[model samples]
Target: MPSKPLTTYVTHQPMTAVQVLEKAAEIVAERYFHGDVFCSAKATKDFLTFKMGGYEREVFAVMLLDSQHSMIEFRELFFGSIDAASVYPREVVKVGLEVNAAAIILAHNHPSGVPEPSQSDKRITSQLKDALALVDIRVLDHIVVGETCVSFAERGLI
Candidate 1:
Protein backbone atom coordinates (compact mmCIF):
# COMPACT_ATOMS: atom_id res chain seq x y z
CA MET A 1 0.00 0.00 0.00
CA PRO A 2 1.20 3.50 -0.79
CA SER A 3 2.22 5.42 2.27
CA LYS A 4 -0.45 7.85 3.42
CA PRO A 5 0.28 11.31 2.13
CA LEU A 6 1.49 13.66 4.78
CA THR A 7 -1.23 15.98 5.96
CA THR A 8 -0.40 19.51 6.91
CA TYR A 9 -2.66 22.20 8.16
CA VAL A 10 -1.92 25.77 8.93
CA THR A 11 -4.06 27.99 11.15
CA HIS A 12 -3.86 31.73 10.95
CA GLN A 13 -5.06 34.09 13.62
CA PRO A 14 -7.11 37.09 12.54
CA MET A 15 -4.98 40.03 11.56
CA THR A 16 -5.48 43.77 11.44
CA ALA A 17 -5.31 45.58 8.09
CA VAL A 18 -1.93 47.03 8.85
CA GLN A 19 -0.64 43.59 9.61
CA VAL A 20 -2.10 42.14 6.43
CA LEU A 21 -0.62 44.80 4.15
CA GLU A 22 2.69 44.75 5.92
CA LYS A 23 3.05 41.12 4.96
CA ALA A 24 1.81 41.67 1.41
CA ALA A 25 4.08 44.65 0.88
CA GLU A 26 7.02 42.54 1.89
CA ILE A 27 6.26 39.88 -0.68
CA VAL A 28 4.47 41.55 -3.58
CA ALA A 29 6.41 44.01 -5.73
CA GLU A 30 3.21 46.00 -5.97
CA ARG A 31 0.84 46.88 -3.15
CA TYR A 32 -1.77 44.26 -2.35
CA PHE A 33 -4.51 43.79 0.25
CA HIS A 34 -6.92 41.00 1.10
CA GLY A 35 -10.36 42.48 0.36
CA ASP A 36 -11.98 45.32 -1.55
CA VAL A 37 -9.08 47.39 -2.80
CA PHE A 38 -11.30 50.43 -3.27
CA CYS A 39 -12.55 50.36 0.27
CA SER A 40 -9.05 49.53 1.44
CA ALA A 41 -7.60 52.39 -0.57
CA LYS A 42 -10.36 54.71 0.50
CA ALA A 43 -9.78 53.88 4.13
CA THR A 44 -6.40 55.44 3.62
CA LYS A 45 -8.23 58.54 2.51
CA ASP A 46 -8.92 61.13 5.20
CA PHE A 47 -12.41 59.82 5.99
CA LEU A 48 -14.10 56.44 5.64
CA THR A 49 -17.63 55.45 4.64
CA PHE A 50 -19.33 52.52 6.33
CA LYS A 51 -22.43 51.24 4.55
CA MET A 52 -24.49 48.22 5.55
CA GLY A 53 -27.28 45.86 4.37
CA GLY A 54 -27.92 46.19 0.65
CA TYR A 55 -25.34 44.08 -1.15
CA GLU A 56 -22.31 42.82 0.68
CA ARG A 57 -24.20 41.83 3.81
CA GLU A 58 -21.75 42.26 6.75
CA VAL A 59 -18.10 43.07 6.27
CA PHE A 60 -16.03 45.68 8.11
CA ALA A 61 -13.38 47.49 6.05
CA VAL A 62 -10.37 49.80 6.10
CA MET A 63 -7.97 51.36 3.62
CA LEU A 64 -4.37 50.25 3.93
CA LEU A 65 -1.61 52.80 3.45
CA ASP A 66 1.96 53.45 2.47
CA SER A 67 4.10 56.56 2.97
CA GLN A 68 5.21 57.93 -0.39
CA HIS A 69 4.96 54.23 -1.28
CA SER A 70 5.69 53.23 2.31
CA MET A 71 3.32 51.85 4.92
CA ILE A 72 1.34 54.28 7.02
CA GLU A 73 -1.91 53.73 8.90
CA PHE A 74 -4.51 51.06 8.23
CA ARG A 75 -7.70 53.03 8.71
CA GLU A 76 -10.78 50.89 9.36
CA LEU A 77 -13.57 53.35 8.73
CA PHE A 78 -16.93 51.65 8.50
CA PHE A 79 -19.33 48.70 8.53
CA GLY A 80 -22.33 48.36 6.22
CA SER A 81 -24.47 46.81 3.48
CA ILE A 82 -22.62 46.06 0.22
CA ASP A 83 -25.38 46.85 -2.28
CA ALA A 84 -26.03 50.44 -1.13
CA ALA A 85 -23.93 52.78 0.89
CA SER A 86 -23.18 56.47 0.98
CA VAL A 87 -19.71 57.58 -0.05
CA TYR A 88 -18.88 61.20 0.58
CA PRO A 89 -15.61 62.39 -0.89
CA ARG A 90 -15.60 65.42 1.34
CA GLU A 91 -16.00 63.22 4.35
CA VAL A 92 -13.20 61.01 3.05
CA VAL A 93 -10.95 64.00 2.76
CA LYS A 94 -11.92 65.07 6.23
CA VAL A 95 -10.80 61.72 7.55
CA GLY A 96 -7.65 61.80 5.47
CA LEU A 97 -6.89 65.22 6.90
CA GLU A 98 -7.50 63.91 10.39
CA VAL A 99 -5.13 61.03 9.78
CA ASN A 100 -2.66 63.17 7.87
CA ALA A 101 -2.60 60.59 5.11
CA ALA A 102 -0.51 61.37 2.05
CA ALA A 103 -2.15 58.71 -0.12
CA ILE A 104 -5.15 56.40 -0.11
CA ILE A 105 -6.24 52.87 -1.00
CA LEU A 106 -9.86 51.73 -1.34
CA ALA A 107 -11.44 48.33 -0.73
CA HIS A 108 -14.89 46.73 -0.49
CA ASN A 109 -16.46 43.28 -0.88
CA HIS A 110 -19.18 41.61 -2.98
CA PRO A 111 -21.13 39.10 -0.96
CA SER A 112 -22.54 37.74 -4.18
CA GLY A 113 -19.02 36.43 -4.95
CA VAL A 114 -18.25 38.58 -7.95
CA PRO A 115 -15.27 40.91 -7.77
CA GLU A 116 -15.93 42.85 -10.95
CA PRO A 117 -16.35 46.60 -10.67
CA SER A 118 -19.65 48.06 -11.67
CA GLN A 119 -19.92 51.29 -13.69
CA SER A 120 -20.91 53.00 -10.47
CA ASP A 121 -17.78 51.66 -8.84
CA LYS A 122 -15.54 53.09 -11.50
CA ARG A 123 -17.39 56.41 -11.51
CA ILE A 124 -17.24 56.77 -7.77
CA THR A 125 -13.52 55.99 -7.70
CA SER A 126 -12.84 58.49 -10.45
CA GLN A 127 -14.86 61.09 -8.60
CA LEU A 128 -13.12 60.33 -5.32
CA LYS A 129 -9.67 60.36 -6.88
CA ASP A 130 -10.40 63.70 -8.49
CA ALA A 131 -11.82 65.05 -5.27
CA LEU A 132 -8.91 63.80 -3.17
CA ALA A 133 -6.34 65.00 -5.69
CA LEU A 134 -7.54 68.54 -5.32
CA VAL A 135 -6.60 68.27 -1.65
CA ASP A 136 -3.20 66.74 -2.51
CA ILE A 137 -4.28 63.27 -1.53
CA ARG A 138 -3.00 60.59 -3.86
CA VAL A 139 -5.32 57.75 -4.74
CA LEU A 140 -3.02 54.76 -4.92
CA ASP A 141 -5.38 51.85 -5.45
CA HIS A 142 -8.94 50.60 -5.38
CA ILE A 143 -9.78 46.93 -4.77
CA VAL A 144 -12.94 44.84 -5.06
CA VAL A 145 -13.35 41.67 -3.04
CA GLY A 146 -15.41 38.52 -3.56
CA GLU A 147 -14.32 34.92 -4.07
CA THR A 148 -11.33 36.55 -5.71
CA CYS A 149 -10.17 40.18 -5.66
CA VAL A 150 -9.29 42.80 -8.26
CA SER A 151 -7.19 45.97 -8.09
CA PHE A 152 -7.79 49.15 -10.03
CA ALA A 153 -4.24 50.39 -9.86
CA GLU A 154 -3.01 47.01 -11.02
CA ARG A 155 -5.51 47.21 -13.87
CA GLY A 156 -4.59 50.87 -14.51
CA LEU A 157 -8.09 51.88 -13.53
CA ILE A 158 -6.65 54.32 -11.00
Candidate 2:
Protein backbone atom coordinates (compact mmCIF):
# COMPACT_ATOMS: atom_id res chain seq x y z
CA MET A 1 0.00 0.00 0.00
CA PRO A 2 2.68 2.40 1.06
CA SER A 3 4.91 3.46 -1.81
CA LYS A 4 7.83 1.34 -0.79
CA PRO A 5 10.07 -0.83 -2.95
CA LEU A 6 8.52 -4.29 -3.15
CA THR A 7 10.55 -7.43 -2.58
CA THR A 8 9.09 -10.91 -3.09
CA TYR A 9 8.72 -12.46 0.36
CA VAL A 10 8.79 -11.43 3.97
CA THR A 11 7.58 -14.57 5.74
CA HIS A 12 9.24 -17.91 6.26
CA GLN A 13 6.06 -19.82 5.63
CA PRO A 14 5.40 -22.77 3.36
CA MET A 15 3.86 -21.08 0.35
CA THR A 16 4.72 -21.28 -3.28
CA ALA A 17 7.70 -19.04 -4.01
CA VAL A 18 6.67 -18.67 -7.61
CA GLN A 19 3.25 -17.37 -6.67
CA VAL A 20 4.73 -14.89 -4.25
CA LEU A 21 7.00 -13.47 -6.93
CA GLU A 22 4.13 -13.25 -9.37
CA LYS A 23 1.93 -11.34 -6.95
CA ALA A 24 4.69 -8.97 -5.97
CA ALA A 25 5.53 -8.27 -9.58
CA GLU A 26 1.92 -7.41 -10.28
CA ILE A 27 1.85 -4.91 -7.45
CA VAL A 28 5.00 -3.29 -8.74
CA ALA A 29 3.78 -3.12 -12.32
CA GLU A 30 0.48 -1.58 -11.30
CA ARG A 31 2.33 1.47 -10.10
CA TYR A 32 2.87 2.46 -13.71
CA PHE A 33 -0.59 1.96 -15.24
CA HIS A 34 -2.10 4.82 -17.22
CA GLY A 35 -3.71 7.44 -15.04
CA ASP A 36 -7.27 7.05 -16.21
CA VAL A 37 -10.45 7.21 -14.16
CA PHE A 38 -11.79 3.69 -13.60
CA CYS A 39 -15.39 4.57 -12.89
CA SER A 40 -16.63 3.09 -16.15
CA ALA A 41 -17.96 -0.35 -15.31
CA LYS A 42 -17.08 -1.72 -18.72
CA ALA A 43 -13.49 -0.53 -18.48
CA THR A 44 -13.21 -1.84 -14.95
CA LYS A 45 -14.34 -5.27 -16.08
CA ASP A 46 -11.89 -5.34 -18.94
CA PHE A 47 -9.03 -4.33 -16.66
CA LEU A 48 -9.84 -6.87 -13.99
CA THR A 49 -10.21 -9.65 -16.52
CA PHE A 50 -6.87 -8.71 -18.01
CA LYS A 51 -5.26 -8.95 -14.64
CA MET A 52 -6.65 -12.34 -13.62
CA GLY A 53 -7.24 -14.06 -16.94
CA GLY A 54 -4.31 -16.41 -17.16
CA TYR A 55 -4.14 -17.79 -13.66
CA GLU A 56 -4.38 -21.57 -13.45
CA ARG A 57 -5.82 -21.57 -9.93
CA GLU A 58 -8.34 -19.32 -8.33
CA VAL A 59 -6.89 -15.94 -7.32
CA PHE A 60 -8.88 -13.47 -5.31
CA ALA A 61 -7.72 -9.93 -5.74
CA VAL A 62 -8.65 -6.29 -5.16
CA MET A 63 -8.02 -2.98 -6.78
CA LEU A 64 -7.73 -0.29 -4.16
CA LEU A 65 -9.08 3.00 -5.39
CA ASP A 66 -9.33 6.58 -4.29
CA SER A 67 -12.67 8.31 -3.82
CA GLN A 68 -12.59 9.44 -7.42
CA HIS A 69 -12.11 5.83 -8.54
CA SER A 70 -8.47 6.20 -9.49
CA MET A 71 -6.10 3.34 -8.76
CA ILE A 72 -4.06 3.17 -5.59
CA GLU A 73 -2.87 -0.39 -5.48
CA PHE A 74 -3.69 -3.79 -6.92
CA ARG A 75 -3.26 -6.89 -4.81
CA GLU A 76 -3.60 -10.60 -5.38
CA LEU A 77 -4.61 -11.46 -1.87
CA PHE A 78 -5.69 -15.09 -1.76
CA PHE A 79 -4.63 -18.05 -3.83
CA GLY A 80 -6.56 -21.28 -3.79
CA SER A 81 -6.88 -24.68 -5.37
CA ILE A 82 -8.50 -25.05 -8.79
CA ASP A 83 -12.05 -24.50 -7.67
CA ALA A 84 -11.99 -22.33 -4.58
CA ALA A 85 -10.34 -19.54 -2.67
CA SER A 86 -10.89 -18.81 0.98
CA VAL A 87 -11.62 -15.09 1.20
CA TYR A 88 -11.22 -13.27 4.50
CA PRO A 89 -12.96 -9.99 5.11
CA ARG A 90 -10.65 -9.00 7.92
CA GLU A 91 -7.51 -9.20 5.81
CA VAL A 92 -9.21 -7.27 3.02
CA VAL A 93 -10.21 -4.54 5.45
CA LYS A 94 -6.66 -4.48 6.77
CA VAL A 95 -5.30 -3.87 3.29
CA GLY A 96 -7.99 -1.34 2.58
CA LEU A 97 -6.94 0.60 5.63
CA GLU A 98 -3.29 0.18 4.74
CA VAL A 99 -3.78 1.79 1.35
CA ASN A 100 -6.34 4.31 2.54
CA ALA A 101 -8.66 2.91 -0.12
CA ALA A 102 -11.96 4.73 -0.44
CA ALA A 103 -13.47 2.00 -2.61
CA ILE A 104 -12.49 -1.43 -3.83
CA ILE A 105 -13.14 -3.76 -6.72
CA LEU A 106 -13.09 -7.48 -5.97
CA ALA A 107 -12.21 -10.05 -8.60
CA HIS A 108 -11.36 -13.71 -8.86
CA ASN A 109 -10.57 -16.27 -11.50
CA HIS A 110 -12.38 -19.53 -12.23
CA PRO A 111 -9.94 -21.95 -13.75
CA SER A 112 -12.84 -23.96 -15.06
CA GLY A 113 -13.32 -20.94 -17.38
CA VAL A 114 -17.02 -20.60 -16.69
CA PRO A 115 -17.00 -16.94 -15.55
CA GLU A 116 -20.09 -17.44 -13.47
CA PRO A 117 -20.58 -16.56 -9.83
CA SER A 118 -21.33 -19.58 -7.74
CA GLN A 119 -23.52 -19.35 -4.64
CA SER A 120 -20.47 -19.23 -2.43
CA ASP A 121 -19.17 -16.31 -4.44
CA LYS A 122 -22.37 -14.39 -3.95
CA ARG A 123 -22.35 -15.10 -0.22
CA ILE A 124 -18.81 -13.93 0.23
CA THR A 125 -19.43 -10.80 -1.83
CA SER A 126 -22.31 -9.88 0.42
CA GLN A 127 -20.20 -10.46 3.50
CA LEU A 128 -17.32 -8.43 2.15
CA LYS A 129 -19.57 -5.59 1.01
CA ASP A 130 -21.03 -5.30 4.50
CA ALA A 131 -17.65 -5.48 6.21
CA LEU A 132 -16.08 -2.85 3.99
CA ALA A 133 -19.10 -0.58 4.23
CA LEU A 134 -18.58 -0.43 7.97
CA VAL A 135 -15.29 1.30 7.29
CA ASP A 136 -16.96 3.62 4.74
CA ILE A 137 -15.27 1.87 1.84
CA ARG A 138 -17.69 1.30 -1.00
CA VAL A 139 -17.56 -1.88 -3.08
CA LEU A 140 -17.66 -1.02 -6.76
CA ASP A 141 -18.05 -4.55 -8.04
CA HIS A 142 -17.29 -8.24 -7.54
CA ILE A 143 -16.09 -9.65 -10.84
CA VAL A 144 -15.61 -13.31 -11.60
CA VAL A 145 -12.88 -13.60 -14.23
CA GLY A 146 -12.31 -16.72 -16.26
CA GLU A 147 -12.79 -17.09 -19.99
CA THR A 148 -14.84 -13.97 -19.43
CA CYS A 149 -15.92 -11.93 -16.41
CA VAL A 150 -19.31 -11.86 -14.82
CA SER A 151 -20.19 -8.83 -12.73
CA PHE A 152 -22.35 -9.15 -9.66
CA ALA A 153 -22.93 -5.41 -9.92
CA GLU A 154 -24.31 -5.58 -13.45
CA ARG A 155 -26.63 -8.31 -12.28
CA GLY A 156 -27.47 -6.34 -9.08
CA LEU A 157 -26.16 -9.08 -6.83
CA ILE A 158 -23.95 -6.61 -4.93
Candidate 3:
Protein backbone atom coordinates (compact mmCIF):
# COMPACT_ATOMS: atom_id res chain seq x y z
CA MET A 1 0.00 0.00 0.00
CA PRO A 2 1.16 3.54 -0.76
CA SER A 3 1.30 6.26 1.92
CA LYS A 4 -1.05 9.20 1.45
CA PRO A 5 -0.73 12.79 2.62
CA LEU A 6 -3.15 14.05 5.27
CA THR A 7 -5.43 17.04 4.75
CA THR A 8 -6.52 19.66 7.17
CA TYR A 9 -9.33 22.18 7.15
CA VAL A 10 -9.72 25.48 8.91
CA THR A 11 -12.43 25.85 11.54
CA HIS A 12 -14.32 29.06 12.22
CA GLN A 13 -14.94 30.64 15.63
CA PRO A 14 -18.11 32.13 17.13
CA MET A 15 -18.74 35.43 18.88
CA THR A 16 -21.51 37.14 20.78
CA ALA A 17 -23.75 39.67 19.08
CA VAL A 18 -22.39 42.54 21.19
CA GLN A 19 -18.88 41.90 19.97
CA VAL A 20 -20.01 42.00 16.35
CA LEU A 21 -21.99 45.23 16.59
CA GLU A 22 -19.42 47.01 18.69
CA LYS A 23 -16.89 46.56 15.96
CA ALA A 24 -19.40 47.70 13.38
CA ALA A 25 -20.25 50.76 15.45
CA GLU A 26 -16.60 51.52 15.92
CA ILE A 27 -15.97 51.27 12.21
CA VAL A 28 -19.02 53.32 11.29
CA ALA A 29 -18.32 55.91 13.94
CA GLU A 30 -14.67 56.19 13.04
CA ARG A 31 -15.23 56.86 9.35
CA TYR A 32 -18.92 57.30 8.58
CA PHE A 33 -21.04 58.16 11.58
CA HIS A 34 -20.76 61.91 11.17
CA GLY A 35 -19.01 61.94 7.84
CA ASP A 36 -19.76 61.19 4.19
CA VAL A 37 -18.24 57.72 4.04
CA PHE A 38 -20.35 54.99 2.50
CA CYS A 39 -20.68 51.55 4.09
CA SER A 40 -21.43 48.73 1.72
CA ALA A 41 -22.96 45.38 2.59
CA LYS A 42 -19.66 43.61 2.10
CA ALA A 43 -17.93 45.99 4.47
CA THR A 44 -20.55 45.46 7.13
CA LYS A 45 -20.42 41.66 6.85
CA ASP A 46 -16.66 41.63 6.93
CA PHE A 47 -16.61 43.76 10.01
CA LEU A 48 -19.14 41.51 11.73
CA THR A 49 -17.41 38.26 10.80
CA PHE A 50 -14.04 39.64 11.76
CA LYS A 51 -15.26 40.73 15.14
CA MET A 52 -17.64 37.89 15.94
CA GLY A 53 -16.37 35.08 13.80
CA GLY A 54 -18.37 33.24 11.13
CA TYR A 55 -21.70 31.70 11.99
CA GLU A 56 -22.60 28.11 11.14
CA ARG A 57 -26.37 28.53 11.26
CA GLU A 58 -28.96 31.27 11.02
CA VAL A 59 -29.26 33.72 13.90
CA PHE A 60 -31.68 36.55 14.42
CA ALA A 61 -30.80 39.72 16.28
CA VAL A 62 -32.26 43.01 17.29
CA MET A 63 -30.29 46.21 17.50
CA LEU A 64 -32.05 48.52 19.86
CA LEU A 65 -31.71 52.15 18.95
CA ASP A 66 -32.30 55.38 20.72
CA SER A 67 -34.56 58.16 19.48
CA GLN A 68 -31.66 59.46 17.42
CA HIS A 69 -31.38 56.06 15.74
CA SER A 70 -28.00 55.41 17.29
CA MET A 71 -27.36 51.89 18.56
CA ILE A 72 -28.06 51.23 22.20
CA GLU A 73 -27.79 47.47 22.36
CA PHE A 74 -27.13 44.41 20.19
CA ARG A 75 -29.10 41.36 21.19
CA GLU A 76 -29.04 37.87 19.70
CA LEU A 77 -32.58 36.91 20.46
CA PHE A 78 -32.95 33.56 18.76
CA PHE A 79 -30.82 30.86 17.21
CA GLY A 80 -32.08 28.57 14.50
CA SER A 81 -30.91 25.02 13.98
CA ILE A 82 -30.77 25.56 10.26
CA ASP A 83 -31.62 28.36 7.86
CA ALA A 84 -34.70 29.66 9.64
CA ALA A 85 -35.25 31.00 13.16
CA SER A 86 -38.50 31.31 15.01
CA VAL A 87 -39.27 34.92 15.90
CA TYR A 88 -41.89 35.70 18.50
CA PRO A 89 -43.53 39.08 18.18
CA ARG A 90 -44.43 39.14 21.85
CA GLU A 91 -40.87 38.38 22.87
CA VAL A 92 -39.59 41.06 20.56
CA VAL A 93 -42.02 43.50 22.07
CA LYS A 94 -40.88 42.49 25.55
CA VAL A 95 -37.29 43.07 24.61
CA GLY A 96 -38.18 46.50 23.29
CA LEU A 97 -39.79 47.33 26.58
CA GLU A 98 -36.91 45.95 28.61
CA VAL A 99 -34.42 48.02 26.69
CA ASN A 100 -36.59 51.10 26.51
CA ALA A 101 -35.85 51.16 22.81
CA ALA A 102 -37.53 53.95 20.92
CA ALA A 103 -36.67 52.22 17.67
CA ILE A 104 -35.17 48.95 16.50
CA ILE A 105 -33.21 47.53 13.60
CA LEU A 106 -33.65 43.83 13.03
CA ALA A 107 -30.91 41.66 11.53
CA HIS A 108 -30.40 38.01 10.69
CA ASN A 109 -27.72 35.91 9.06
CA HIS A 110 -28.18 33.45 6.17
CA PRO A 111 -25.84 30.50 6.37
CA SER A 112 -26.35 30.01 2.65
CA GLY A 113 -24.64 33.37 2.03
CA VAL A 114 -27.70 35.03 0.51
CA PRO A 115 -29.02 38.20 2.09
CA GLU A 116 -32.26 38.60 0.21
CA PRO A 117 -35.35 38.55 2.37
CA SER A 118 -37.64 35.57 1.90
CA GLN A 119 -41.41 35.96 1.81
CA SER A 120 -41.41 34.73 5.40
CA ASP A 121 -38.86 37.37 6.32
CA LYS A 122 -41.09 40.12 4.95
CA ARG A 123 -44.10 38.65 6.66
CA ILE A 124 -42.31 38.50 10.00
CA THR A 125 -41.13 42.05 9.63
CA SER A 126 -44.65 43.19 8.92
CA GLN A 127 -45.89 41.32 11.94
CA LEU A 128 -43.23 42.80 14.15
CA LYS A 129 -44.04 46.20 12.70
CA ASP A 130 -47.67 45.83 13.68
CA ALA A 131 -46.83 44.47 17.12
CA LEU A 132 -44.34 47.21 17.88
CA ALA A 133 -46.73 49.84 16.58
CA LEU A 134 -49.08 49.01 19.41
CA VAL A 135 -46.39 50.09 21.85
CA ASP A 136 -45.25 53.06 19.76
CA ILE A 137 -41.87 51.58 18.95
CA ARG A 138 -40.74 52.30 15.42
CA VAL A 139 -39.00 49.67 13.35
CA LEU A 140 -36.32 51.70 11.65
CA ASP A 141 -35.21 48.87 9.46
CA HIS A 142 -34.89 45.12 9.00
CA ILE A 143 -31.42 44.18 7.75
CA VAL A 144 -30.39 40.77 6.48
CA VAL A 145 -26.67 40.23 6.87
CA GLY A 146 -24.69 37.32 5.45
CA GLU A 147 -22.35 37.36 2.47
CA THR A 148 -24.32 40.53 1.78
CA CYS A 149 -26.84 42.62 3.67
CA VAL A 150 -30.01 44.34 2.50
CA SER A 151 -31.90 46.98 4.40
CA PHE A 152 -35.66 47.18 4.16
CA ALA A 153 -35.83 50.86 5.00
CA GLU A 154 -32.97 51.70 2.64
CA ARG A 155 -34.61 49.84 -0.24
CA GLY A 156 -38.10 50.96 0.79
CA LEU A 157 -39.01 47.30 1.15
CA ILE A 158 -40.86 48.19 4.32
Cα RMSD to the true fold for all candidates? 11.2, 10.2, 9.8
State the C-alpha lDDT per candidate.
0.61, 0.84, 0.74
Question: Which candidate ranks first by TM-score, i.e. highest?
Answer: 2
Best of the two (2, 3) by lDDT: 2
Tens-digit lDDT string for candidate 2 (10-92): 67777575665456556544553445546466666666665677688999999898887788888999999999999999999
* Model 1 C-alpha RMSD to native: 11.2
lDDT head-to-head 1 vs 2, winner: 2
Higher-scoring candidate on TM-score, 1 or 2: 2
In order of appearance, the predictions have TM-scores of: 0.60, 0.77, 0.72
In model 3, how large is the Cα lDDT of residue 133? 91
Which 10-residue window in model 2 sums to the lowest lDDT? 28-37
Candidate 2: RMSD to truth: 10.2
User: Sorted on TM-score, highest at the top, how do the candidates line up?
Assistant: 2, 3, 1
Query: lDDT tens string, model 1, 16-67?
Result: 6655555544443234433334344433322222121123463434353445
Instruction: For candidate 3, write residues 1-158 as lDDT tens digits.
Output: 99898889989888667667667657754553232222344444444444323577888888676776655677888899668999999999999999899987778888787788999999999999999999989987788876666778788977
Off by over 4 Å in 1: 1-66
lDDT of 3: 0.74
